[model samples]
Target: MRLYLTKAALLAAASLAAQPAFAQESDDLIVVTGAPAPIAIENLPAAAVVIDVDDARVRGDISLDQALADVPGLQVPRSGPIGQQTSIFSGGFESNHTLVLFDGVRIDDPSTPESVFDAGQDTLGDARSIEIVQGPLSALYGSGALGGVVNILPRRGGEGALNPRLEIAGGSFDTLTANAGADGTLDRFRYALNAEGYTSEGYDIVPERIATHDGEKDGADITTLTGVFDYALTDSLAVDLLLRQREARVDYDPGIFGNIAENPGSEIQSDTALWRLGASWALSDALSLRLSGGALETDRVSSDFGVAGDEYHGDRDFADFSATWSITPEWTLLLGAQNEDENIEAVSFGSPVTGEQEHWGAYIATQGVLGPLDVTAAIRQDDFDGFGEEFTWRAGAAYPIGEAARLYASYGTSYRAPSLFERFVPFYGNAALDPERAETWEIGGDARFALFGQTEGLELGALYRASEIEDLIGFAGFAYGNVDRAEIAYAEARIALRPTDWLTARASYANTDAVNAATGVALARRPEESWSATLAAERGAFSGQISWRQIGSRLDTTYDDFGFWAGTAEVESYDILRASAAWAVNDEVKLYIAADNVLDETYEPVNGFAGAPASLLVGIRVTP
Candidate 1:
């Protein structure tokens, strides 16, 4: 693996030195969902990344978090298989500080008492595209958007007659997956449907009884189905409808700290159903109106047998409405409101703490463009029954430099209410915990240039961001409370190039310095520095890529057997290398091979956890 990475890096250098002559192309494409108006990447002032559907498809069946694992500015603390928590730092907020969406709909989990869950769900297989804007987003998305927003774009039907796809894969660790989807248009309407199933025996980072509790039995199984409908009512009117359902059964082994004590088994089952209805009307060429309404329902149950027996059951309903108007060619306004009702019941089969609580919030945004620049501003006031009203806001701007390049910048504020686990879960819940609040700021830019006037493009981007948090929340001594404030600064850069029709290359580097500003302590699950690079070449029906990723040392805090505390514990870092290739036998079939942890690096993303060993997979795809 190391040899392959060295070869790829050398090849990239050679390509740069060769400076092969090729054609040059130029164009300016504006980006929305981040800045107020569409602005070219080169002139966009903030640090952002866009992964289109084509790129996503080429990445195969990897979870969205795994596919983006090496992105310089992002941090994904992988739990196992499809479960991970993805968080971006503007200053130093956790995943709860980030806001995530699917096709403009908030996808936060309703099972955890708070509408937030681990970032794992955001990686559903139906995603067609993903956009990441790193900075404060309070003004645009309201509270809980202090770090950034990640939007997953769904695949909608185009003018084509029909599009269909199928994929199946199996590998070691008892992992298996199957996916199928289709999109088509019929006269005045278009429709899309997708379904997927995934299961894995899972590889334990910590052996079942050796660690803390029992780490050997950690694994997951999940299934999902989605449908989309769109219709053109008239030349000036259109409507869209979306429905989705998900079910999951999960089990994990919690490691023991010292000697074997108890073998507590956890079984969790969850289900979610959601629907969206929307309409768009064109009042004029320069003005349009869009109205959308959505509802979500979720149910979850978890049972832990033996040791610390516990059971949890919960249900939630959410409704939201929003309107967007294009007042002019370059000016847009958005107004929206949301309400959620949650009913939860939890019992510590042995502890004697059983309780339930109910939670709800309403939000607004405006954006415009001026000449070569775009600007956006937004605000929201959330009224929690017990916590009172809290407000958040954000402001951002982007500018285009020339035809192929841009810059972007933004600042925002955010806040998070305590979750049921933190506020009311028996001994673990600290009703006295304070709400988490934060302020984040960021600025960045990117540039595109021809390599020796070659048609193959070379692009470079960089960003600097900082954040400060107050009244942060965490678990300590089996209770939740307001922790010390935190501050973080991060900087990163990336360079990507396509040296030839058959060759592509990329390199990235990042530095993050996060501290508990009040206590001067380092943050958890964060690396001080990280780097990655990849190179690939394709010819005719054959293509292959080799890549390498590295993470720096990290720190974790844990309580000792004495029930005291351990602080700033150190963990070693490690590197991983991977390679993959494919052969298109014909239009109807293809054969592919992939390998990970080629070096079998003995390291964990988290302390005392199991990391992937060297493994390989071979698969085939068939299309009619």
Candidate 2:
């Protein structure tokens, strides 16, 4: 890890030292995705990252986890991609700090044990694009947007006539997959459908100390289905609907030193469903209205091995309803509200008895724009059956300096309420734990400019973020406790240049500084610096990318100096390397290959789980 950091720093320094120094290109680029009008990046106070479908295709054999690898000041730990959890962090908060959304709808359960939802698995295989906004966003999105937001836009509407595709893949551990999709319009009704299924005999995720650790490795199988439909009425009004369902079965294997009798075998199966109905109506030549409403549901169960001795089950349901009115050419207003309900039940590890809890909440928000400036403000008030009421809020603004550059800033209050698990875990939950609160501020801008002799364009941007947190719920002295405060400061920058008509080069760097105010200690295992660089080029029918990434040292939460677990120590700081490529055989067919740990650097990012040695994968995509 030390060597990796040194090399990365040197490389960054070198890039900075040799720059010819050119101002970013400022232009009238449309920014319709985040706000009502087509604003430029420099005009919005919230720092954001956007990845389009074209960028996604040329970036190697996309490992869903790797797709998020380059986002500045962000962390997406990998347990071999596809099926693992990808936690998002901001201003030094945990995974739950960020909000993951699908078409502006939150996909998480604020009423559950772990308030944050894992969107990596659902969006990776069929996404059209992804946008990430860094900083507090309670004004635009309400609670759970404290760290930031990752919104996925799935692929829809294919050009020309009907288009269809199929894909299949197989790799180590008997991992297998099949994906199929189609897009077409019938009688003025355009629609798209995507479906995928995959299974894997996963590598062991347990620590190395247990005797039976090898076979105790866990595995997972998942299937997902999605569809989008749209219809136009009278050429001025349109209705749209979206539906999705995901199912997963995961087997458990406690690591190397775990005792089977005490830990036991475990399995979990989960089902998630979502639906939305909305319409876009033109009220006048200059006025318009967009309305939408949707609902989401999830069901999950965790059992001991295959036995039902003591089971853990949870369910979450939510509704999203919002209205947008284009008040004028330069200004618009949005009013929206959401309602959520959740429930959980669990039995003991060896007993069949059960215990349960229920929770619910609601929230609203509004945003508008004035010429080159835009503003957003929102608030959310939630009510937990036992916890009563809690509120979160935010406000922000953006100003365009030129057609190609903009300046933006924002301030907001966000929060993470105790998850059901955090508040009620049999042996872990603390009844006295308080809901975590955060006050955050952000500033940044994006600029576009000519590059490589002024023949092509380049995009450059940077963001600085800081936050102060209160009542952080954590564990201390074998019991749950609320740490009075925590502080975090972070920064991220990105550079993407189209040096030639057929080639693109890009790089990103990020740094995070965090401290536990109460203990006057810096959290371990939180990498201080991280970076990624890639060069992609294309010719004829072939395209490929060479990429590199490094993660700094992090502290282990399981660290213990006591004699009881002596010599069974943990290590900090590890680095990894991976590379991938692909080729287009025809307009509707393509083939790809990927190699993880290309240099085969051997080190563990997470304790116990031996990162995979160098591995290979080959797959084919067929579209007709």
Candidate 3:
């Protein structure tokens, strides 16, 4: 079946490309995460994918996790349903290996064991675009870039004189949602603001463990507010400010294999806040300077049956200073410095713990464009308070084959530093743990042509990535220790086609092999095979989309009766289907409906945990 599907996709692509060539305007999209300043997408030598707000609205997706699941070589693991613990894995690496940024500020929680970012706590209502860069990028972004980087760009003002949008939605499980926003420009000042609220009476995730109870349901409520302000002092200088906050309360079931009868209720309350201030000045026609500073604060409280609760608090601050100089029309140089400070406090089972850490880094990079060839190289050095210093580097090249084709290749190295919780926690801390390291290389190409008498876009790419870590930290004998070495290899293929102005299609397949070098056992939750596809179209005032995703079988571990020893088990494969449609009633009003899990497939993304069933949602949006 897989072979047949692959062949069909290839045939379709070939047929589309065989048509006559037609003149069309070139794509002018700009991406900011690949370098010190915004650069055209065609100039980037790395594998990157960009999803805009219109794409999410057409697909009826409300969260970042759902919007990113269709990207190639990416996996999202959820503990239960929406508003649950969520993690993203890239190239078979753990969640912490990927760096997440909100408006250019890092969002990793210092209180967590691995400084992982939770995607479930926030919605996508205020986002303008999302950029995903696949591969090691420690040379550009500091630590926590071992796998890749995800950057969320917020909406800004200045597009029009005045703009406002409002939306309301309701769905299965008694869920309700409402959001409103506005943006505009006045004189030298431009501003944007947004607010959102959501609530749901969710379903039980671990039915077998909670079946003895009387129809117990887990529920959740969330609220978010965001604002952006920018002022242009002159044509050569500007100032910007951003603020965002989120509050959430979520109820969840007990552990999958645990005896839920004893624990009646489990819930968590969390609050996250982010703030940033930045300025840019064009010192000369060929020289520019940029400076930015930001802070991220998080607080969380968790409890079971109104007892045995834990409280966690984390605060982090960061600053960046950079200068870019254009030596010639073909060459450019960038130099930057960064600093970060983090503090964490935790109270678990009446025991209190606190820790702090600091880091400093500096980097230099150069990019050159000569004729049809583009080349870039960068190097960075980072120093940790207790871990000394580490260095990383990257190099990439791209060459245009013709007016409508290009070939690119890149090689880079990245790392992930141990978190404060991993080094200073009471009983399960390991101060001797070393930072995880990774290296990756990739090559790919793309082409553009005409199909069905209209201009069309087509891209095909492939990549291979391998990573290894020394002194890997794990739990052993009720204590954290550097017990094993781990390695992983991943390969992926991707295809994207736009046959017309209103039609788009995409398909991707990935295979991963990961194991502990000492035990020779496969890594848990790393599937060997995974595939996804999406088809979308729009005509007149109507738009629709259909998506499919599948995951292959993998190995998992289960604890014994006393929850002490571990044993391996096999998890069956599963597939899902979803569809959505939207109609624009007029210039100011639009209606939409979506169906998730249309086939009602029963499968578990995580072992022993039940997934969501078929559900429906309807919404109306108004803009003026």
Every candidate's CA RMSD: 8.0, 7.9, 6.9
Candidate 2 lDDT over residue span 439-496, tens digit each: 8888877777877865436887787888988887767767667856888888878888
Off by over 4 Å in 3: 1-28, 31-40, 208-215, 255-264, 305-308, 370-372, 476-478, 497-501, 558-566
What's model 1's lDDT at 343?
Answer: 51
Query: Top TM-score: which candidate number?
Result: 3
User: What TM-score does structure 2 among the candidates reach?
Assistant: 0.83
- Which of the numbered candidates is closest to the native, going by highest lDDT? 3
lDDT of 2: 0.60
Give the count of colliding residue pairs in each prediction: 30, 26, 0
For residues 62-128, could you state the per-residue lDDT of candidate 3 as single tens digits?
7788777777777887766678888888878777888887765777788886778787667788887
Error of 1 at 79 (Å): 3.0
lDDT of 1 by residue, 1-624 (tens): 110111111111111101110111124343332122333334334555456543443434356666556556677766444543333433345757666666666566644544454555443457666656556655445446667666666666655667787877777777777778888899889988889888877665342323353435556788888888889999988888888888877665432443223333765666777787777676765544555666666665555663334545555455555555667766766665666555555554354433344433545566566666767666777766556677887776777777656677777787776665566666577776667888777787777788845653797878788888898876565667686788889888888897776787989898988888977878886778888999987899998888898888877553343323455586777898988888889997777777888888766565444566777666666654
Candidate 1 lDDT = 0.62
Ranking by TM-score: 3, 1, 2
Residue 431's lDDT within candidate 2 is 62
